[model samples]
Target chain A: MKYWGTLLLLPSLLFAQPEFFGYFESEASTMQLGSTNYNFGFNKFRLDVEARPNDHVQIGANINIQQYWGKTSWDVYDFIPVDHPTGQGLIFTIPDTILLDNFYMKLSFKLADLTVGRQQVSPGVGYAWNPVDIFNSKSLMDPSYEQPGVNALRVDIPLGDRSTVSSIILPKDVLDESTHQFTLKSGIGSFDLTATAAYESEKDWQTPLLGRYDVSERNLIGGSVIGEMLGWGVWVEGAYNTLKIDIPPWSSFLPPDSEETYAEYVVGIDHTFDNSLYMLVEYLHNELGVKKQENLSLNHYIFALEGEVNSLMQDYTFFYAMHPTFDYVTLSAIVFSNLNDTSGVFSPIIDWNVYEDTNLSFQGSLNWGDSDTEFGLQDWGLIMNITSTF
Target chain B: MKLKLLLLSPFLLLIAHAQGPTADQIVDRVTNIMSPENSHSKGSQTIITSSGKERVFEFESWAAEKGKSTLTRYTKPAAIRGQAFLMLNNADDIWSYFPRTKRIRKLASHAKKQKMQGSDFTYEDMGGGDVFQKKFKSRILTEETRDGAPTWKIEMSGIPEEDPPYPKIIMWVRQSDYYPIALDYYNEKDFNTKSLVLSDIQLIEEYPTAMEMVMTDNKERSSTTMRTLEITYAWEPPKGFFSERNLKK
Candidate 1:
């Protein structure tokens, strides 16, 4: 990551238009580990670079170096070795520092665009989906960022002044053990629709392949739509995946009714008060168990609300996700820095212009889950971020 | 200068003896006060606070005459620049234009009270005297001094006299310049909740120019301070700054 950052800075010495943007984040937490509270810190320093030599072509890449300086369980150690001795220690840090998050070359000819190489695939508003991010993906335990799980090609064709059609494809990789994944997206006016399909041979990073879950081959499909109405906006989305598990010798260890197919869907609403304030609410539900109807049916549900106050300050958002069957809630917040120039990805992420973007704020999420059946797991997180753009 | 003052002194004294002008007269004075021909110059600045927040803004203002006006902002790094506000305030009517995402949106009267750039000041503040004509009724109360300067104490109430954002404003104007030096904004409960303190008035070719103003809300711990660091009264600016090409560029 440091080397990539240095290379980007070198361009400043050349054309002086060294388009380099990056963010540095650090998180410290004290988790109530069963009976004891433990202190830990997660630090990440990332660098992103983009270069356009001419109007028709451009290249960009993002590299992040993260250090998980904390304690871990034996299972965590066995999966990904933390630099430490045998026993449970005070520090179990992952020293593999440099990770490539994105690298792609884009060519644009008038209204059309084409991109190739390892890239992040943000699909169907799911937040993080690795069907395309084949190189490195978000840990299923913590879905924050994703890596290219597969090398893919993307093309976007403009249909008219207010419409576009886009598609993407990824080839076989060592991990997925198979070839071919595809996605299609279309947009017109205030509405958008998307669909995806993929075939896998072995266990992909996105899914597990073990016991009855050891899926050597899998196929998936998804669709979504978003549009505006009388002074408000609405969105609808759905996704489904089918898995073929390799029957293993230890079949008795797994549940007898393990399902080979799963599906999820979400619907949302957004309204804007003039141009300054806006409110958005959404609900998401996943089908956890269909093969075993009595055991587990409805997986999880998310309900959230967000709003902006003005351009300079006073933007706030809150969200609550529930597990009705288990009786739990996931609470979250979205905040922005009103003091910074309203620019870049974080600007929209924080809704600075909607109210006052300069206001510094803190967002927190608390998850409540049940202990009896792992249906309701409880976890909480608080974050404070400051941002400015040039 | 002596002749001019002597000739104007009797008219001023007569107006004072008559107990200040009516609400309509006050509105006329305010409207004439901010004419493009009355202001010193036009330029743009990026406002940065002690907390490191910044916003870039530009205005084309005149002192005595009405002319074209424009305001634009850089919303993103690479996206085309867009107009934040545009107005052509003439003697007939005040018109404003807003660029839309897909088309254009025209603003109406009710939007004036909303804050500008999320600051305490509203578009109504920028509207100056336009809304005052129809929305308010004023009467002169007494002679007063603000910050040791002579002023005319005035009482203004919305026509319906219902609770407005600020139900009343007691303005203190400099006797010599006729420019407000300070004012107290009162809420519906008749409490002096907010105040605007204007200072650093310099005579730009015989006009009292306000260099800075700080609006403080006593009820809340919040305040907005604006300091106009420089002013240029030239009629002609560098070419292309106000053109639509530059606005989109």
Candidate 2:
């Protein structure tokens, strides 16, 4: 009863005269593997409210409601499930969840802006991959999805009309200094440049499933640039991370304690032709990634699945193309290749503006490789979605 | 003698008012009135297809250096909100900002031929006010009446080496205020492709300004109407406001 009371009062407390807006989306998807097929359906409803009570203060919030049901051939029961276990079936599950994606208040001053609460901060210039995105990791399968926000306090100060300095603090508990980040952004001539640094305490690291280990403090430095060269849009981004880890004493062929540095970088270019066709190509190099199947063990794969490390191969290449085929329709294609293992995913999409503020999209992805390669274990998939905003 | 001199002064004033401005002077005056040193405006555009489907978009715009540099930001239509375009001083390169991606894209020069926001107006139509004077040579054809006012019918042709979008344009300029009342654009094949009509003339800052404009695409059977909601003249924006930094903001 107390939680319900607070939820009812949230809107009144946030705004005196608020503006309400959001969207509703419904999707149906299917995956094909050999002679068997799996299907899923979901609906998402979101509501957003924003208000400026005065010249110096502003508040905003976003709430998401999702309901989904699916049946798959893969073994998903081995991991912890986010849904309530009410159904009686081996390959079927229904999940329902409600979440607050963003809730923040901003205070504006003469020289700075301060924001507190859950918010999103993305500092990279890459289209398909963003190695410098330290605060939040985005899904490569659906690059257009809105990233989840982080609970933090942020401040931004303007050095001039073309430059800004910003800092963020993510507290784990009261008076904790577990995670923090700082960034500087500026425009030099036609180029937009950014630099970032972050620090995280060791207590935040989770224990791996296979071994007991202690992790030390971690530090990160990253930079990115976006500009035009020879009539083409070009961008480059990179990051370096240093951390110390103490391996289990029983582990063989590994040191008990070691400090390691991992580096990652990406370079990309894009051009638009005379017929309004857009094309892009990008290459990525990740030093922490495995190059061959023999170098990766089941424990390491489990660590990658648990999000303890970046889930990518040593080298990758991406290509994209988009064309407006008609007045109301657009066709696009994307390809992501794991160059180290010679595996890749090819996707084609179509978008149609059916009506005002309404859109329909159909997309499909086909993966190909050997059994041990990156793309071989994934099933071919197709999805159709309809979205409307109000 | 004083009475006789006062009577002759009225006749002298009439003679001065009777002499009309030449064609070049009329074009120059119109350009000056349309392109101020700096200005800001809020407006809405409504596009109507032949099947009677309508879509509306709202925007805010700022311009400096007599329309040599301009910035336009869309504020309505959730899908395109916060999208901005920055064009430098008559440069062929134009920059576009997408809020979702938080990236700036430089459009090629050939993009001028594409439709703007699915509307009938081409990108070239929204370029700037000085496009006509910079690309075409004007000649007065005749004196005619348009929209209940005496107007000069003028014919303008593109320079051979410039290769402008339109081969020729026929314009009707109002005699009283020198504002362009209507324009018909022709392609290289001498076919009329588009027509623009201006209405609701009002005086702001001692200059005649059009509060409403309608553009029609002849081949597509579609039209777009733009209405100015608010306008201010001589409001110079701060320096660096048109830079790439502001586009991201």
lDDT of each: 0.45, 0.75
> Candidates' TM-scores?
0.49, 0.79
Runs off by more than 4 Å, candidate 1: A1-17, A74-96, A126-150, A173-189, A195-203, A206-215, A247-252, A255-259, A272-279, A289-369, A373-390, B1-249
lDDT tens digits, residue span B79-165, model 1: 112334433232111123222121122233234444444444555454443444455677777777668877777676766543243
Tens digits of lDDT, candidate 2, A36-128: 677887899988787777777767778899988676233432222212234432232355769887777778777778888777666677877
Tens-place lDDT per residue, model 1, A21-42, is: 6555565555442345555566
For candidate 1, what is the DockQ-based docking class? incorrect
**Interface DockQ of each model:** 0.04, 0.20
Task: Indicate which candidate wins on TM-score.
Answer: 2
In candidate 2 the C-alpha lDDT for residue B159 amounts to 84
State residue B73's C-alpha deviation in candidate 1, in Å: 9.3
